[model samples]
Target: MKRRPRRTIPATLTALVLLAACVLVAIVAIQLAIGRTPIISYRSVTGTLHSIHWNDTAPLIAGGTCALLGLLLLLAALLPGRPTVLPLTGDMDAGVTRRSLRHALQNTAATVDGVTRAKLKLGRRTIVARIRTDRTNTAGLTDAVRGALDQRLDQVAPLNRPAMKIQLRATRNAP
Candidate 1:
């Protein structure tokens, strides 16, 4: 089945909070049944409930707080998280992490002729490379890097091919 990943921390936290609340309620119920004083007195809780009114400022504030919390949780559940791994082209359930892909692309760029050092910023839609060369004339270096990157990308075979952007910089200006 095709399944999207969930945000683990938030879901885990929510579950833990609910579990704690249920445990507390169970403990309170047991105390009441055994004729012992509950941690939070049942009389106080009943008194508070009796005193609460729909039109009271306290109820309004409590309702507003609950609504806001519900809205926040809804947004968290609905919004997609940042993708750490990009899927491969084949049928296998295999994928490459962004860090590894960036490393591979940087290596490809660095191996190209006239490229001294290569730094890559791999975005969602593009791979931007900043290459440094000590050579005075960098005539066809950009194209060479691009071609090499394309070849490497073909081998990698990611599902979504990002556009390549090459920025060549000489160690020192020819002028």
Candidate 2:
């Protein structure tokens, strides 16, 4: 059987809140069954056959709060999860996992002159390469990284060519 995707954090929290509320209600019902009043102050309207009326302002505020919470939770649940793979070739199965892509990009960036360390973030339409370098000529380093990335990417020729962005972090000492 196909299992549903895991709930997002907000959805999980909402579900937990609902469960806790049901448990609280059950506790109150049990207390009433045993002929004991709940610890909280409340008139037994049903038992006394009294009509209950909700004041406009309080009810409206409460209803609006509930509506907003529901909408927020729905939005959270609908948002897409983090992408795990990047397609590198036209073949359906030819792809690299996000981790592999990061490693590969880092390795490629490390090939650039004066780059001591490289970190890469692969976004939907951009490959952001953050590099630590000892060289002060950041503009030249950026262009070099971009050229290396272009060559590396051309080797695979991914279906979508996400633009490369190079960010340099100058290091005090050369590695």
Candidate 3:
């Protein structure tokens, strides 16, 4: 089945815009509050505070510009991108790792005597396994898969067994 794509936040641009807005607002507000009018000269501004003439407005301007850029970047990140089945390289490491572990669990489930197929999924600290089997009595197979997988995975990744999910599907090929 085709899976829907996922959307995520854009970080870089968002940071730039937020940083620019904060610093610029601070500088402008501080200068205005102190009753100082800056003199603009060729991409620079100069102002005086406390009887001291600061000749460089470049820092303030640069900071403000960076804030604006940061804001714009933040906005750009909010834009939606095409959906994808695979997660982007952002904050999905834990989820991906869980998926890998779940796949492993499913493989283990399929190794049972009567099991025909198995699917597994991992969430947070739990592993869920679904098994399709052809046996009339599934209790034994269920217990076996659970015990075996729990022991095996615990030795490797240490997952919670109580949270494990097992779904058994009975098939017609029972011996």
TM-score of each: 0.68, 0.72, 0.43
Model 3 lDDT, full chain set:
0.61
Candidate 2 at 174: error in angstroms? 15
**Predicted candidate 1 versus true structure: per-residue lDDT over 47-110, tens digit per residue:** 9989999999999999999899788888889987657888889889888888899999999999
- TM for candidate 3 is 0.43
| lDDT of prediction 1 | 0.89
Model 1: how far residue 5 lies from native, Å: 2.5
- Show where candidate 3 strays beyond 4 Å: 1-96, 159-162, 173-175
Which candidate do you rate higher for lDDT, 1 or 3?
1
Mark the regions of model 1 whose C-alpha exceeds 4 Å error after superposition. 1-3, 83-85, 90-95, 110-121, 130-147, 165-175
Please list all clashing residue pairs in model 2, or write none if there are none: none
